[model samples]
Target: MNLTVARLTVRGLLGRRRGILLLVVPALLLVISVIGRSSGSDKHDLAVTILGELSLGTLVPILGLIVGTGVIATEIDDGSIVYLLAKPLPRWKIITTKLAIAVVTTWAFAAVPTLLAGLILYGTQDGLAVGFALGTVVAGAAYSAVFLLLGVVTRHAVVAGLGYALVWESLVGNYVQGAKTLSVQQWGLSVAKAVAADGAIPAHVSLAAAVPLLVVVTVAATAFASVKLAGLTLASDE
Candidate 1:
């Protein structure tokens, strides 16, 4: 990746109130986990609720949206991306650079806290903590790629990202069986369930299906975003 592009992406992602916003969700998760750990709540319930629903469902997607879009969408919207695109750099490198920053940021703010929350809630019993943590890592990376493509493809990147996460994944997926197959949350959940002692939690999609879907989605999104960015640069110059 380009160091210059990587530096600029990091600066943009962590600058202003954006960095603070990224911290809020993870901090909130850790706090809640600590409290839940002390309370009368059952460990299994706490782990599934906080790590599964809160971490995987809510925190991962939103962080992916903010970091992914914030990395490039803001620059694109402000027309500052022109200078970067005009540079004699490989388009894929630029995309990869920004993508690397987004993945790391999302992992730090989402996955790390998730692992902590899982451990606080359930320890290593039945592989609960590690399982969910692994799920978060993979899911966070996938979310970053998907949302990064949305950032390049839409002016309403955040709105679009939220709609897909909340409306499509959370809402529709719960009631619609077919929708769950296409959900990042469910895919992650499937991964988590696979790691934990048998039947520790529910998983809708099979491991075979979920793993491939997750890989395909991330790679496709990145490939498409790179192409779109190249096209945008060419169109702007015309």
Candidate 2:
């Protein structure tokens, strides 16, 4: 991986308005978790609703979109990517460096917040906090790679990522049992179920199925992005 590309990716990510927006979802997760904690409601119910639906279901996908696409989208949009591509660096290295930045930053923004949110809502009961944290981290990494591929392949990366996350995973995955098998959120949920105390979380996919799929998706997306970037052709805006 090219450190220069990685350094540039890091600067571009944190130096934009998107960086400010990145904090919003995690902050919202924490605030809602605090409210749930005080409700004196069923702890499991609160944990499921807060950490399961809101944190993993909502925040993780959104942050993934912003960070994943943000890494390359803005540069591609402004025609600045041509400069980077003009260099002799291997296209795969550039993709790998950017992918690393996206994954790590996404983990910090999504997974850590999910952990904190779980603690606020459930206080390590049933190993729920650690389980959900693991789920989000793994899911966040997958989202980063997939959405980074989207950024490289499509100008409408954010819209595409949102449709998959919200419409496909959140909406359709809920209604269709088979759709859950193909969902990163559900795959990660399986990991959470395995890690948490038995019966603490319900997962539609099995850990055996989820683990291999997660690895395959992440690897395939990164590979495809690298191949696509190697063939990228930047025409003049005018």
Candidate 3:
């Protein structure tokens, strides 16, 4: 992919109204962190739960959905993607470049805020800061790839992504023990388990299962997004 094209796309995706929308998630986390810290109600489990569940599980995925799909689907919808597609760049390169940008942006916005939120809430106890940071990074990257693929393969990417992140993973996993095995939020909690001091954070899934699933989901999503972009078609305005 052309670096110039990627740079331009990144700048545009982050500029204007989209940037405000992207900031909403991290901003919400930080705001809640400030409020929680000031109220003198800070507790270890509460910190762990908030950073673990809300930051990793909810905010990261939402930001990923907005950023990942915003990067390409908006272009596709407005027909500007034709300009990029008409060029001589390899399709895989284009997809890879966009995916990379999405992943990095998601991490910056989601993971960094999570780290700061952790520090604000818990100070330096039980490796909570480190564990939650790592968890956010992994979850953010996976969310980027998954949502990027959604952007390429479907027009209703935001809706579908929200449904999966909110309804399927959050709702179903909460109710069904079997569903926890298949949840990304749970996979991220496993990473938290590895980073946290012993008995500090808890995870339902084991490290053995979570690691492979994280790698596979991220790599597979990236590969599938590349393939989809290679064969991507823009619908006619007719």
Q: In model 2, how large is the Cα lDDT of residue 164?
A: 92
lDDT of each: 0.90, 0.90, 0.84
Return the TM-score for candidate 1, rounded to 2 decimals. Answer: 0.97
Instruction: State model 1's lDDT.
Output: 0.90
Give candidate 1 misplaced runs (Cα > 4 Å).
none
Worst 10 residues of 3 by lDDT: 229-238
Q: In model 3, state the lDDT of residue 83.
A: 84
Question: For candidate 1, which ten residues in a row score worst on lDDT?
Answer: 168-177
Looking at model 3, the pairs that clash are: none
Pairs with backbone N, CA or C atoms under 3 Å apart (clashes), candidate 1: none
lDDT of 1 at 146: 92
* True-vs-predicted CA distance for residue 225, candidate 1, Å: 0.3
Best by TM-score: 1
Better of 1 and 3 by lDDT: 1
Q: Write the per-residue lDDT of candidate 3 for residues 38-127, one digit (tens) a residue.
A: 775647867977897889888888888888888788887787888888787877788778878888898889889998999989977888
Residue lDDT tens for model 1, 94-213: 988889999999988988898889888888888888888888888998999999999999999999999998998778876699899999998999898899889787788999999999
